[model samples]
Target: MNVAKALLSIMTLTSLTACTALPAGPSRSTGPLVIQEQGSFAAGGKVVSTPGTYDNNNPAAQGQTFHGDHLYAFYQIPQNPKPLPIVMLHGAYQSARSWETTSDGREGFQTLFLRRGFPVYLVDQPRRGRAGNSTVAATIEPTPFDQLFFDQFRIGKWPDYFDNVQFDRKPETLDQFFRSVTPNTGPYDADVISDAMAALFDKTGPGILFSHSQAGGPGWLTAIKSENVKGIVALEPGSGFIFPEGELPREMPSAAGTLTPEAVPLADFERLTRVPIVIYYGDNFPVEPTTERGQDNWRVRLAMARLWVDAINKHGGDAQLVHLPEIGIRGNTHFLMSDLNNVQIANLVSEFLEEKDLD
Candidate 1:
């Protein structure tokens, strides 16, 4: 009996070991992750100087001269590139790093799309990130606003997370998310940003423009200014919807504040009709106005976005607003591109590009 029990125990241990062993064959590989070219450039800014002569004795003196108002773009072209490259622009309080990696250290949209054979250009807009020089100066107070942004970003409440939210919700991930917030070296000026982005398009020729949050307004203006913007993918653009000069929507009121729409000339508005545009929003928006400031903020924006889409389609333009929840993809936060299900979201975008013939 003892000999039989020993044999059975040995057999069970062997089975467990086999189960934990690593596979022997070669792992899957869809060709090499090769890059034919990778480089960076400063685009669309002018040189500015103080009104004084050079002071070699004191370089810190008021006679400083430097280039300001330019944007920084980093490009990665694959060995075999797609027809149209993708130009990525971040939103308020962010830099090009926004698209580089997720808060939890997962692969971001930048690399994901790059692997799909598309050239990727990541931009640090004027007066932010690498392009820190600005024509105008602004005071940057070290205000403790992480909690406020935490709520505003729809990640969760200050001290708690929403049920089954797509964010990782780990302490380290939250820390990384907060640390990623960058301060602008200059004030937020839509005209300056649009001008710089227009210059980027001018350099890159025709490419798909991907903008998030605040950059949406400038993205529209850039497309209007430059014919090189062939398509657009906007993620949760919180503001900057442009209407015809005489057809602006009324201001939307919410617990957060009032949401307003910008206006553009009819000719400029018509420029957007030339390209396909898709706007994506994540979950957790209240059906009606709520006392929760964070939730209410996006509620108004989503409403405004629907109107904006209608206006675009009315003008013979191809524009769509996709609420992920309505389509059965639930629990995503405002930063859908960086959420846990970002790959799934990226697949949806890939489908859009293929459908529009922009791939």
Candidate 2:
């Protein structure tokens, strides 16, 4: 985090407060102006390449260590932007825009939460969006544009709509969805992302982390590590746990190049229980769909959420898995934040946070 000296010294930082972005008129509301700032931090650092210098007579490759991955976020405080803040994390292949703007021209959670008088910090996870890249350019590979997400995420069929598709966007909106997709670089390090998140959380005050899908994994880990994280609202976390698949029980790699594998009890994460935890799933999930992959994905995710809720509750953590269909808000997809009924869900989140005393 001290690297602020390294980066800020190199360029001017961009900090956007609520008043600065307002129209030439009154405050958006009677509340404080929303304060927002965006910059990248080296949560954890690593030398990605050997340092070298380019000179008139000779050119050498500058040794570079990836300072963990970059963290790009826009934070808002009311009075304008304040805390008990909600940190929003996007899922795989998506950036923080997951909470900023929707493809249907709808406002993202950032706007909704602001209206509710809570500050918000939105994250672009490593290798995505404002969170920029870390690996050598040649090592980067883009996530394939495929039906995998559409079907698995329950957005719709590849070229057709699945039964009761809840995505609710016009056909033209597909362009926006596609445009939001970016090629990703890997050996994705969940631990580094978690540390960056923790660093950000420590720098800010304790509050909440509202994470979506893949980001849910690290969100759990970050909350586990940081006392600053008071609560976590995980939206359909993958496999219902922190740490990535293929890495097994899950190993967290630090910027210093240390790999810490999962060795703690699920009870350890009950730190979440000290506060409150909620796992929210969208509609059309429990009922089987046409694609075998989608069907299996749904079943697995549902089971995962269930398992987590059970485990967390057993550990004295107040974690609940909510199915939207069961609550009268149906036809939602994995991307519930952008659904036509998004406001309904955001309201549910706001009310839950208020009830839990997170607000």
Q: In terms of TM-score, which candidate is strongest? A: 1
Worst 10 residues of 1 by lDDT: 22-31
* Residue-wise C-alpha lDDT for candidate 2, range 133-245, written one tens digit per residue: 66635365564755767776777656766566656457667678777776455456777678778888877778899999888778888887789988888887763363222
Give one digit per residue, the lDDT tens place, for model 1 in 215-294: 88989999999999999999999778999999999999999999988888999999999899999999987979899999
TM-score of each: 0.89, 0.78
- Local distance difference test, candidate 1: 0.89
lDDT of each: 0.89, 0.69
Residue ranges of candidate 2 with Cα displaced over 4 Å: 1-44, 47-57, 62-68, 80-82, 135-144, 240-263, 287-291
